[model samples]
Target: MSTYFAILTQVGEAKLANAIALGQTLKLKKMGVGDGNGALPIPDRLQKALVHEVRRADLNQLAIDPANASQIIVEQVLPEDVGGWWLREIGIYDEAGDLCAVANCPPSYKPLMVEGSGRTQVVRVVLIVASTAAIELKIDPSVVLATRQYADDKAAGAVMAHEAKANPHPQYLSKIDGEAKIAAAIAALVDSSPETLNTLAELAEALGRDPHFATTIADALALKAPLDSPTFTGTPNAPTIPHGDNSARVVNARALAEATQGRAGVQGLSGANHGASPANKFTVSALAVTMRNPATGQAITKYATGALTADVAVVGANGRDQAAVIAGTASVHLHFIFNPATGVTALLWSASADAPTLPAGFSFFAYATTIRYQGANVI
Candidate 1:
């Protein structure tokens, strides 16, 4: 992630700074806010700032899944030589691309050892001294955690995602949220023998979630050794490529037919007789779209032409004009080759003038069929 800055009001700076210090005290306590969740290892120096400059930093590339990494930055406004109360927590708005409130940010403080001797000891405060810390906030924690939990529904599938990022698994692991996720991490590692797997399972069960995740790992063991073992170099099956569920397709087809029925020119292509190609449908998990439930997740698909369909559409004024002046009932007949994904049925169509005739002596003849034409090295 990259980093940038914005300004804070004087009063706001003071309030935020005090909050930072208070946050440190909380960290020192076992039972504090979020179990000391928001605390950062603050340095001394930039703790007291009359005004603070916030910076935006991207951490997407960090070892921790960028999504799992916490957002924070710290800077000191007060010089180490002169210190009293330290500026720590800072809340800012319309900054860092519209951040509203953040904690343990820049403009905070920590202590430093100025000097020490066998006979004497000297200590000074190290505060957030820079004009800005190295990072900034992205969204609200509620949003972040909610999204994570939502993704966790597909327990093993979601946790093994980094390993199986190419294609995620289905939503079978909804039982694997929270500690179950932690267990998934532990289980996915190499050397996860039955003992280790059982240990993780016991931990997960203790946490109140189901113990099936360990079994999933055990399944992997049968197919291949533990994930990280040198002997186990292979692909992870995840982000499962959702195949066209014919059953679901049929359900959707029925809905489509219902929607098109009793409507003008909206005849929906359907079952055996209508001769519409059986469509391929790839259904994405509802949570894959976002880490949070407040927003929905959507899947995009790319398809190629299939062997069943042969004709393509030639869109223009005239479909049949002998002497190269193409003119037909539909006035057009386009052709193309297709090798579509088994999951989808791409059909080409030749558009017709609903009126049946055109001023240029144009007549519509046939509708064209188009299937996906080619495969691209798609995402």
Candidate 2:
């Protein structure tokens, strides 16, 4: 049997018995060490405290002894704590600061670092209690120091818990899962993209590192003319409408110039009149004209050739002299004379209602309008 053993003090026994009877927990709070006056000692149930306490600290850990079901294990880590005393006695204190258990230890001299010898110490006390169910197991982590081995064990346990397949941290991704998603994302990035822009860096470089590239493009497009009804500038040229086909088609400046100055098989009737005049003669078989007589101020309809529509006949050479008419009615004669040098046409009416005389050096053609008496005014 080992001389190292712990026993409940008188006050602790009463408290434990009362806690068990009341179904309450006896919360063990701290563990203390003593020197026993520099001598090894034995524990007693009558003792309320150690012979001489050297250090006291909140309990670091509390657990039931696995090998002894009735034994409650209380532990304290004296991490860089008090020194220069002999650890010959140990004590367990409850929440009320009452000594709950006392035990004797193999005497060990703890030295300060200034003495050139120092070491961290772990102290434990095992109490054989009637019912550990009435003993508190939870501890306040803030009041106690942990051993390196304890910290490492706790860290390993936490990692294993985080890696548990059942439930994981909501914000974290597992390594295997994260790798799969990353690979899938990479595959999608280049699934149908061009080889030059397959990667993020390549795409960024292609866009020239301009943060406002899209806005710049939009602004540039705004400066361009729209396709519909675009306004052009600076002497724009276009295909012109063909001559003699007088449908509504746009004519370019070149087409206008060609028409006015004459092209092959076409007459140039321009304001300058520098081209040849047309040689086709004017012919009329019968003339029907409406006029208001200036003397009577009445509307009159005139018919020439006595309402006979006759086939045209050339009365003179080149048909440019006098027009043929019926012999007896009051008639109006007109000569349409063209001046080829000036591109102008002048109409000369006979002042006596007779055949008009053509002006000198002017090519001419003639047509006649006649007058008859109708009782009602006809327009």
lDDT against the true structure, each candidate: 0.29, 0.64
TM for candidate 2 is 0.43
The 10-residue segment of model 1 with minimum total lDDT is: 26-35
Q: What lDDT is reached at residue 228 by model 1?
A: 60
Question: Scored by Cα lDDT, where does model 2 land?
Answer: 0.64
Question: What is the Cα root-mean-square deviation between model 2 and the actual structure?
Answer: 34.5
lDDT of 2 by residue, 239-320 (tens): 8768765666668865664455433220111111112222222223234333222222233333342221111122333232
Per-prediction TM-score: 0.14, 0.43
lDDT of 1: 0.29
